[model samples]
Target chain A: MTLVKVYVTYKESILDPQGEAIETAIHGMGHNDINGVRMGKYFEINFTDDAKDIDTEIDTICDKLLANPNMETYRYEIVNAEGAK
Target chain B: MTLVKVYVTYKESILDPQGEAIETAIHGMGHNDINGVRMGKYFEINFTDDAKDIDTEIDTICDKLLANPNMETYRYEIVNAEGAK
Candidate 1:
């Protein structure tokens, strides 16, 4: 089996209000040294060994359902599922 | 500066409805090769050079805010911000 780890995050030009809010909350808890924070989404997808065109499928899945191209960017790593476990 | 990447995910025993929903949607889109999916949260935090007790602070933040101890677990990697970029 193949395991894919995907990370989706906002583009540099986009404003991440949720991240800012979390940063503010963290500062309130007295961790003043933490200067910045950005929030993102993570996904782990498992594909059977027989799956065809894995790379193409992953990209299509990310573009169609995992990320909003207008605001977010995504990247992924494919690894053997057995080794991952 | 220090850069920390935090990943938070549901514990093994927890049911990930959102992940299931996404998987269903993907299959509906004709990606039958995908067998499993897990959704999680990711955070990138930057700490200044002057930050004290970095490791301890990270643990406290994760325990208190970044993850729910009852249902979620988290892990992080810390790296030099300059080198990471």
Candidate 2:
């Protein structure tokens, strides 16, 4: 089995209201040192595959569903469970 | 510096539209075995400190800023650079 982790976040140029809200809350709670906060999405996926073109298949997943390429960007890491042993 | 990683996600009872969409797309693209998908949030925070009540402080950050305890659940790990040695 292959376990993949995906992280999706807004492009740097896009404003993140959730991150901004967290930033304000942090500052309000007397933690004035924090300058900014950026929020992102994470996923854990398990698939049974031992194929060479796995990255391409996962990229297709990202392109079709995991992210909106215009506003969000995604990055992923694949783990080979058997190889780790 | 204290490095913290936070993962926030909806409680299991809550339906995840994003995850459901991904599941449908995966099956539609001919990978039919995937049964479910759950998505969450991840954050990496860096702070400078060496304090015993660091977890409490970070919890405070989570309570007041990083997470919504009512609708979301959170878990965090603290990394101590000095302790690794």
Q: Identify the leading candidate in terms of lDDT.
A: 1
Highest-DockQ candidate = 1
Clashing pairs in 2: none
lDDT of 2 by residue, B1-85 (tens): 5666678877778887877877777888887545556688977565555445657877898887667888778898776755321
Clashing pairs in 1: none
**DockQ scores for all predicted structures:** 0.92, 0.34
Q: How would the docking of model 2 be graded?
A: acceptable
lDDT of 2 by residue, A1-85 (tens): 6677788888989998987887777778877545456688888676765445668877988888888999999998876766321
Q: How would the docking of model 1 be graded?
A: high
Q: What is the TM-score of chain B in candidate 2?
A: 0.80
The TM-score values for the models, in the order shown, are 0.95, 0.72
Candidate 2 deviant stretches above 4 angstroms? A49-52, A82-85, B1-3, B11-17, B44-54, B68-72, B77-85
Q: What is the C-alpha lDDT profile of model 1 across A1-85, one tens digit per residue?
A: 7899999999999999999999999999999998889999999999987898889999999999999999999999898778443
**Candidate 1 at residue B16, lDDT?**
99
Per-residue lDDT tens digits for candidate 1, residues B1-85, read 8999999999999999989999999999999988889999999999988987889999999999999999999999998768443
lDDT at A10, model 2: 87
